[model samples]
Target chain A: MLVHHLYSGGKDSSLAAWILTRLGYEVKLVTVSFGLLDNWRFARETAERLGFEHQVLYLPREVLEKAAEIAIEDGRPNNAIQFIHEKALEALASLPEVGRVSDGTRRDDRVPLLDLSKARSLEDRFGVAYIRPLLGLGYKTIRELTERLFIVEIRESEELEKADYEVELRHIMREKGLDPLEIFPKRHYQSRVLGWREKGI
Target chain B: MLVHHLYSGGKDSSLAAWILTRLGYEVKLVTVSFGLLDNWRFARETAERLGFEHQVLYLPREVLEKAAEIAIEDGRPNNAIQFIHEKALEALASLPEVGRVSDGTRRDDRVPLLDLSKARSLEDRFGVAYIRPLLGLGYKTIRELTERLFIVEIRESEELEKADYEVELRHIMREKGLDPLEIFPKRHYQSRVLGWREKGI
Candidate 1:
């Protein structure tokens, strides 16, 4: 019954680990470091603080170098989602004991379900079980729970605001005034959508 | 050489149609009508004014009825990107001409490349070609061209603010401080993304 909390010492991952621990799951915190020693030390330290078996895996430095290029592709480049999945898989591969890979996945994140795809994909690709305790809960709830649990602030995820990549794309299309989501695709399928304000049904 | 400008009668698609016609593509405009005759009539009239052969294809109606129900799950939900893709595919399927489907796709819209996967799947499944002519242009430039060409304007697309599902999803997530694009991708793939602030990378 080795349950691994893919911990990055962040709020969501740490809190998820905390929840599973309270549930009597034998928890191991999995942190992957990409040459950031401070982060590496903090994640390892936090895992120990939580009284869980802890392990640190170093990510290949190339991943960080490549992230920006992946982030700013002009045409249909695989977004951050794909890169994150690959990196997680790599980390999982290097772990000592991984029964089920759990983490600080929450509804507050983009396409909350997107993780399920990545996890399922990882499971299929690597034969690992990926579980998320915080799937349906929204941002407000996640924030509340994090505070209630006294978990470390969920702050690893940093959105580049104002005239950044997303904003840059928005600028190009916003005045043309398209829905950023339509072009970017929040929905992955092509289904007949109802609730539309169509003139005549 | 029947080139159907898959017109939403909106800026991007209309602009795309405008370009290919000037390139001597012998373009014919096709507007897929689902859920609204008045809207289609309006779109159709715009196509006619462009002096191009216009064809209107109606969706099966049931698809529209199910989009919202399909977007959500037991209080959890998917995003709008899925519905748009589903609708786009439905429209693409009914294209009568055996050539290819063309639309107002531009360089910026090329990121997730929804059309990439969709076109591949459609071509593999049905051998339909999905072509985007404004491949390299940005919205600012497209707007300038639309003015130059005197393209008919559809205020509904503008007033509707385009990507209704996405805007709604953004509104839903924003109340809780969610990233709109991530929420929107719920429809396409459920790949979890980890964000880094302050070299959170």
Candidate 2:
């Protein structure tokens, strides 16, 4: 069975990838780049190291806004994070070679707000299975598996900004005692902002 | 400031109590028993050891059901989790001496979902500031603090279940195994259902 583990290059995402691989599932890694994640490269590298084809689905402005709106309120910052998976499900279902999309959804995610069937149904609109492995495990368990596997270089949320994940932090704290840039150091890697200028939200 | 740190003898709640204490706040730990939490004694003991005024909030059936109907999803389990907090918050606010309510709301909790201004507005139509000291800190930091401070006994989420936390594991096998107790285990923990012949659920 092909488990397209949602490989976000974070600890939980990578751990899910590792567990599914050990289970002998055909594992693939997928990342949804908000076009500004601080850990984009780490996510990409980990997926590559895991021997999975890494794909960065650009999160459009509208999608990020919707997801962030929920995340901020839900305290589960990726409240609609699985929407990224939904998009990936849509992308892969169109491809003749791939019939399934999988992810690394966890059990103790405060709430299992994401429904894979939502992705599956959205994909079934195109007739494909959206799959997820390690969905039943907690984040603590995911952390244990990641450490046990000895694959640790992961990204932080701050890595999302292209100019510097510090872009907004700097802008907001220009007059404060601490430089926002110093507080939140910039990430080395970068990604294209497809929707930034036109939408300007 | 009187930080009424909400401690449910749970890690996040207790750690929140400790963090504020370290920052020079006079912390009074509050533990609410909604009745179904089977290990109320253990929680009481932990609170006593920590030397905080541990208070147990009684969850009346009508109030819990009112809160539950609003917070829980119709088909899915565990929606009662948020309402449980709502009930706890109401009880916490009713204390005569409490000026401001503080909590163990950590980086991990959906603080926006539990915003006291929102809860208070809907709840008693009164205002209380709900403060979280470790709002932006990571779980690992909290784990480290829990150990370093000996704030309370470090227990997993299993402690909250009227049944064992592992019950979710078994329940998962029977159900879709999609969510861990569908969020929080739906224990009849002191919901006026357990001791007698009448159907509580």
Per-residue lDDT of B5 in model 1? 63
Interface RMSD of each: 21.2, 15.9
lDDT at residue B74 of model 1 (Cα atoms) = 21
DockQ for candidate 1, C-alpha atoms: 0.01
| Residue-wise C-alpha lDDT for candidate 2, range B1-201, written one tens digit per residue | 575766656555555665445433577766554444444555466566666666555556455445334433453333445555666666777677765576555434552235423534533443444555444333434454444455332223343332212232234323443444444444442311111121111
Q: Would you list the C-alpha lDDT of every candidate in the order shown? A: 0.48, 0.47
Docking class of 1: incorrect
Model 1 agreement with the true structure over A12-63: per-residue lDDT tens digits:
6665665554333577776655543334555566556556677765567566
The candidate maximizing TM-score is 2
The best candidate by lDDT is 1
For candidate 1, the lDDT comes to: 0.48
Looking at candidate 1 chain B, the ten consecutive residues that score lowest on lDDT are B192-201
